[model samples]
Target chain A: MSAPAPKALLFDVFGTLTDWRGGVARAVAAAFAARGAAVDAHAFADAWRGEYQPAMERVRSGARPYAQLDELHRENLDRTLARMGFEGLFDEDERDALARAWERLPPWPDAPGALERLRAIALTAACSNGSVGLMARLARHAGLRWDCILGADLARDYKPRAGVYLAACAALRLRPEETAMVACHDHDLAAARAAGLRAAWIARPLEHGPGRPAPEPEQEWDWIARDLHDLADQLGAPRP
Target chain B: MSAPAPKALLFDVFGTLTDWRGGVARAVAAAFAARGAAVDAHAFADAWRGEYQPAMERVRSGARPYAQLDELHRENLDRTLARMGFEGLFDEDERDALARAWERLPPWPDAPGALERLRAIALTAACSNGSVGLMARLARHAGLRWDCILGADLARDYKPRAGVYLAACAALRLRPEETAMVACHDHDLAAARAAGLRAAWIARPLEHGPGRPAPEPEQEWDWIARDLHDLADQLGAPRP
Candidate 1:
């Protein structure tokens, strides 16, 4: 807490600001229901989310050229559907809509208000792996305002990469030290720290869904909090 | 107005959303006054702006590699001061602060509200030659909220370049035909049209100050209005 506040906070959107699992599952369930099919939407959502890292890895390793999250998500959705034995259940347009489910992900209960308070103290931007268009749609959907969108598209690289972190800071005209990377994942924070950025851990116990063991911090971050509201409080953000 | 409304509107920041002339002049006057010097701040602001295109052209024509607006603005400020016979009038730190005067450009009277209204109907973003950092700070200063920041730094090129327009649309996941370039300058609109985007002209009679002839439409554009409010009304944005 004694460390000076960062001039800006670059946030990891998926598990940090949003309840991606729950939101995607709900959308998946509705999509299936519309087709008179009853599938375990949570399992499907998990399967789709499972493909995320490897998809990004393909680009990160130079195995594939950079692709937007939208494209990756769509391809992953198709793969997930095929893996689940529902390959032909949805047509191209339906598949596209289902992929866009990521855009409608809901904010965690504390996210919107905490972000508002945090913005009063520092510039807040999404530094997710999601593309700018995806982030923009999601921000509108969830009522979470960002000063600007910065991530995969802008960086042409995904999270955990030094280039991604450095690119976001450079775009903001801030040195890594002047910006803090806030995320619910240890690996993201670890990579950010390695890239010379300050790190703040925001615990999201329900990020992977209920009954799964929650993640615990593996190392000291510049700031550690139970949730975003706690982080806002710790940062001395003004109350509404 | 026969064409479909664009899914996103890319704005030209310098003269479109904000009054760079008056704002920079005010800041220049304040900075000089602090040093007990009286000068024609407006002329100074004009000279600084006049250097803009030629400086950008250096990068555009590959005479210089890409540099953010901040760097270009700082260089221009120095050259302008030197040309005006005020070289060494300020220290480096002072010069840097004065260069940042661009970030505090005042919004046109109808800009902030019109932008809010337009946002209700479509995605809105800054597509100026300004760097993402400059646009972000300027938006905060002017109370103009953009869904995302796009332009020079993101595209690695300045506007009037086809890549700049196409890059902005690409970042939004929008086709050029699905987005509109909104600006006060005919040349910008002409470039945007040549790059396959629709165009809207918002006239700023006093953008260069009174006594200067207001720029008229040199050719047909998708939409034309005296100000942003008229543009919003023509777009059928809901009244607040």
Candidate 2:
């Protein structure tokens, strides 16, 4: 059966709306090259992102008290650099720029246009693990027109935690059932669905890296589409 | 001396961006007429708004938890109706439609264009006491292109409270010095300045009612302008 129409669409940003892996890898290569460092940029990007969950888990598990994604990303970069034996290669300015790469990731091919269409029909916001500021900067940098920025900082917790999903809904004054969570990752949708929000999966075959298997939905979602455009069509938003 | 340049322009919506007094009066008149009641529409509008601060004070004083402005407005409407000797005249749906009139308040003549100009130069958001959902709907309804919805709901408190100003800045990841609070009210700017945000006062002489004296700045603010257009000009935002 078709799910009831949602009044809002809350999106997962990193892998869903934008190609963070590719964008981060490109940014890393440029930053390192400027510092005369030789590194596998893609590998570096992967290593940095790989720490994302564990870093957030520190807060989620109550070991940390809700640091923003930006701070965690910076710390992760420091640890990753140390492990890669490139410690102290770049100065503080260089390190800061590298960490900010997350804010400048390019949107997926269909994201900008699809978001415009979807926004015309219902409220659209970033419901990600990113901090509110990170989301705002990313939206501005990537031309993603979010109705509002909602995420970890607002909830003071990370994803898969009920607070994140419920906080986004609360920020919009919407009921969980009145909102839909859109993501490429099954785990995100699972958590959203568990929190009583409708879920839609968008396939991003290469979100992780080339040769990575496309995500398979762990459960039946309210809708599944090839990209944001397809999802917009499914949501009955008129194409411009 | 001129103030430091602001990276974001946070706006007060009710009277600064929209003519709430006029809109509310019109809505109230229509609703009462539908119920075959003759009431002083303008007086009723003023009285309804008069309760706004007191209602919010309940939350601020910890006597009540934060409630959405929509709920407060409804309660205020009922109280105002009863005081006007028209209690039980309108049903719940009618009361709801009247309360939602705030969502449909028309933008001031220069608001849409001036905001477009200002937005191109810096981040722009509705930093009002309105709930996130109410602000989002009002933006959509009135064609206010906010970068993000921020304010009361996010802060979980009302304006003139330090938390509200600081919360909006925190959401955008901006320092108080990097943001400017633009409002027509002296009290709001005073509170903003107290919270360390730069303040810009825009004159809305008719905000309260016709022939009402325009608010004179009680203290020196960073910038004082005739309207949003003048503010945009002072801020070096290019006119389209």
Candidate 3:
């Protein structure tokens, strides 16, 4: 019985607003130290984000039709460089600039000032499976000021697929209970509350990096909080 | 030649950054002065913007399928209130709040400081036929700070269609000559330069309000400029 304060929120970029395993383990340790290789750059950024949900479960099981989380992060960076053995050590324009290291992820030091104070209290976006040109170049390289830029190429698919949370609340005409779905993941707020929407969460304890173990909320989420500047101070917003 | 400086620009919201004929003639003179009646609100905002391109040429001649320019401005505001006779004087919730007066139009005094210095040079959006919830409530009621919000509800259709300027440069993945449309209408920069993109224009000499002449550029448009703060000082964009 929670959702009464949403006009829009959406979000969930990478690990809920940047820090994709510390910017793809600092571009996989500067593309394996420009080739004089060493290895374990956060275990190759957890083997390219564990091949991101089995490549969006091959386009959510229809077995691929919708290609683009930047071509499934450049075909899951050639199977995370052939499952970490590092096959043919980078070419095709250095694996297209290491598949744009998830478009240069870096926010999360309070995710760009709590997304400029939760965008003055409402309508924010990037409902990410990433790729409206990788969330418009990761929201201009992580300053993250979205008012538009909905997810998975306007819901062709992906996300705990409720048509990507009802196509980011029908591209803003809203009303999936007037939108909410922020996330740090409780299976993406139980698939955005089974698609009727309204959820919040937050808590990205260094999003699988610093010391690891950061998984907490497993159940009820209408508004949890801790990181996005305490969900923009529990949604009141003012203090930018 | 003039295709070099763009990374993204797009734009074209109702008479290039708002003024929808003086904000839909001050919302059709306050809804016919709350019905005491005193019409001719700028000729009913030019007969509801002259039924906007024959209601997007019935969804670009397929004879209608795609809709949402807020349902063709609520069916052209009931044919601009029965061609100004005021048919049954405003009902369906005051014609759904006068078809949201194009979502509270009003920008254009150098459109929110030249779109905050052309979003600090480049990536700005709203390739407008309007409706991502009426350009996200007319960019939060006209402060207009878009980084994303592509046109014709993600190019379902409308605008001097070239699939609505190549579906807003293929939804930010760009490369319609790296994008650049801007507008004040030289046939919407000649259909965003016949869809290969790159154009600029921006004049808006009080956009059909003052002495009413306004539109000048009939051809050559790579960067014209005069209004969006001289196209953010010819795109160098520093002085806000």
Candidate 4:
């Protein structure tokens, strides 16, 4: 039987839509070339991705007040760049460019058309820890077709927090049941379901690399799909 | 010479974009007709709109905790429905529909194409206090092409606070200088400029209705457009 229709779908940005690992690697590769060095962009990408959680935990646990992802990403990038021996390769301008690459990540092959289809039905928006500015370019660059973008900054807290999910519903003028939170991460869906939003999982099996632990799907997600397009069909959105 | 383009455009939704004043009155007229009463929707719309600011200011200044526009609108709607002698005209269903009238607001005649054209050259988004869901519907209903939505909840504070404008810039990932905040209200633009965003004004001459203090486009806006279309032309956005 079909699930009840949602008023909106809030998608996770990093792995569910765009291939964050590959996207970050591509940008890292470009930066390396600009510096006349040949660094392992994949390893570099992995290193940056590795920092994702501990950074937020610092804020989540009240160890730090909220800081925007832009600043957090910059701190990690600065540290990683030095470790990678790309010494003095970036001045302020180059650093900003590398930072902006987050805004232009490529989407998964299935991302854009599915989003277009979803928008034709429920309102489609991004609900992610990525600051709004970062997510908007990623959508525009890869044609992800979000109807709106909701950033972590919206709630002043990161996902897994009930307030974050509720704030999204509050903004959309939707009750929790009227909204579906779609993400590849199990923790995200768990928190969403806890907050009363229906949940959908779009597995990006390659998010961490071929063998490393990929963020898994939640068993309680209302629907599951191989990617955004599959989830779009399950949601009964028109195929693009 | 043109003032350097402001980084973003803020909006005054009710009369500025959607003719809430007209539409609500008309919607209420239908709601009243269902009750066999001769309700002046225009007057009702005016009275309801009049109650908006002071209610918001009550929350803004901390006399009350922050409440969504949906809540504030509904509270005012309740008071006015009784005052209009339209008692027992609404139950939960009717009240829900009436509150959602804000979402179905029709755009100004000049709004849609102007925004589409503006998007071609500049990073355009909505900076309004509407709930994310309300703005989503407003944009959908009005064919507004905002790239990302910057609402009050994004900052956890309402307009006129530097935090609100600062949060919007942080979301767009643009410096306050690079982003322009556009709106029809003098106070909205003034707050944005004070918080570091460049400012543009579109005169909403009929905002408060005929001869109602004749609210003028008298602010020191860096770029004064007759409307969004004029602003698009001024910004060199490719005409759609």
Measured by TM-score, the strongest candidate is: 1
Q: lDDT score, residue B163, model 1?
A: 98
Model 4, B1-240: lDDT tens digits are 277755555555665566778678778888878877787788998888878888888978989888888888999998888887766878978887887788887788988888777766666777778767778888888788878888577776688878888888877777888888777878888888888888887866766566766566766678887777788888877776
Docking class of 3: acceptable
Model 3 clash pairs are none
Give one digit per residue, the lDDT tens place, for model 1 in B1-240. 677889999999898999999999999999999999989999999999999999999999999999998999999999999999899799999999999999999999999999999999999999989988898899999999989999888889988999999988888899999999999999999999999999999999999998988789998899998998898889989988
| DockQ for all candidate structures vs. native | 0.85, 0.68, 0.23, 0.78
Report the candidate with higher lDDT, 1 versus 3. Answer: 1
User: What TM-score would each prediction reach against the true structure?
Assistant: 0.99, 0.97, 0.39, 0.94
Off by over 4 Å in 1: none
Candidate 4 chain A least-lDDT 10 residues: A212-221
Predicted complex 2: DockQ: 0.68
Model 3 over residues A1-240: C-alpha lDDT tens digits? Answer: 345779889888888888898888889899889999898888778877888899889888998787778877788888888877888998889998888988888988778888878878788888888767678777788888868888777777888889888867886887787888888989988988888888998888778877768779988788999788887877778894
Candidate 4 residues lying further than 4 Å off, grouped into runs, are A210-220, B209-215
- TM value for model 1: 0.99
Candidate ordering by TM-score (highest first): 1, 2, 4, 3
Considering the two chains of model 2, state its CAPRI-style docking category. Answer: medium
What does candidate 3's lDDT look like per residue over B8-123, in tens digits?
88888888888898898998799889888888788788888888889888888989898778888788889878876888988899888888888998988778888888888787
Of 2 and 4, the candidate ranking higher by lDDT = 2
RMSD to the native, candidate 1? 0.8
Instruction: Give the winner by TM-score: 1 or 2.
Output: 1
Top candidate on DockQ is: 1
Candidate 2 vs 4: which has more DockQ: 4
Candidate 2 segments whose C-alpha is farther than 4 A from its true place: none
